[model samples]
Target: MTASHILLVDDDVELTELLADYLTTEGLEISVANSAEQALALLAPPARFDLAVFDIMMPGMSGLELLQQVRPSNPIPVIMLTGKGGDIDRILGLEMGADDYLSKPCNPRELLARIRAVLRRMQTPPSAPDTRVIQHWGLALQLAKRTLLFRDTPLELTSAEFNVITQFMQNPGVVLSKAKLTERVLHRELTAYDRAIDVHVSRVRQKLSKVLPEQELIKTVRGEGYLFIGEE
Candidate 1:
């Protein structure tokens, strides 16, 4: 089995070295990039990475800007490292298509756990031998390919967004609470005031709305949660 390769981007040299050593000791391949520009270079061809850990605050091009640039062409799952109490940065990272996030000055063990969780969600189960397509309304979700289509036109979705919509489509008309979604999609328990699940759902809704104007496929049930309105 090939080890997962991670690109760690941060301006703190000592911190990056510490994480790289710790993650490497845990049987994962690590690549260190001290700046967003360096990270972009490493992200280019011939340097495939399973996941990327980027610090939200960086010199020159910020992590958010780097994410915006990378997301359009690359679907590599990203986990942002934000400063403690940096709620806005965390939310912005998710809106820009990040899979998960961690607060900087964090415990290496926690970061490792989050990394494993995100990678696990991105993996396809070997038990499913054939492609399974779930069609609802005009949307088609190809489980094997992990692609979503609207009226046969492909709808781009990040790894997190893909999982978010999959849960909704599979359980149409079912109200999935934030706690359930966080566990299912992110493979972690929901923390108080954590809005990662909400941001992911919002992104999916925004994408769906572009192709599904005048149709509200996913509905919010006020205090309950979100419900996917399937064809009755």
Candidate 2:
């Protein structure tokens, strides 16, 4: 299993250190940052931060601010750490794209639970049901293998990108809205600010273009979502 690299951002010295030690022991690679500016600066180079754990009360720039600025460009998952009894902050944190929220007096085990849950949802298996296949152009989809093939040549796809393509190919020419795509791929309800699906769609299109450059396989519908274009 691939270990997740988590960015720990907080202004509290003792708490950050303690959390870092505990999370590191749990087989996660951790990078610590004291504030949002520092965290954003660290996120610039290398670009290997898989997730971020942010404290909502940091000085200079708040955790929510950091997310607002970066969420437009970065797709890194985030879990916000809020002060205990601050329900309003917690609600706002989630609204602002925080994947999950942890309270200050949170139990180590509880935080671990939320972390694993979020990661699990993000990494859910895409084992397609047996006895199903969708063919477009000269491309074939192996439902079991979760692989796309053009003339039996396998195509590499990112997890999210693969999920979206799988859904579209399974029901070719079916117009799937953002909500439907999100539910299928992310396994969650769609929010207006949900751009994750769009990112995955862009990536899937790129891969398809590389293999099927002669035509646009996935057609975009005006005022709608997308469709896999091919004769039934």
Count of backbone clashes, every candidate in sequence: 0, 0
Q: Any residue pairs clashing in model 1, and if so which?
A: none
TM-score result, candidate 2: 0.56
lDDT of 2 by residue, 1-232 (tens): 7788888898888877888889889998888999899998999956777778888888899988898887746767787787766667766665555665667766777666666656765653557446556688887888766678889898866445567788988888789998888777666667654455665677778778987788788888877898888765
TM-score for each of the candidates: 0.96, 0.56
Candidate 2 lDDT (Cα, whole model)? 0.76
Candidate 1 structure quality by residue, lDDT tens digits, 146-204: 88999889998988888999999999989999899999999999998888999999999
The segments of candidate 1 whose C-alpha lies over 4 angstroms from its true place after superposition are none
In model 1, what lDDT does residue 187 have? 96
On TM-score, the candidate that comes out on top is 1
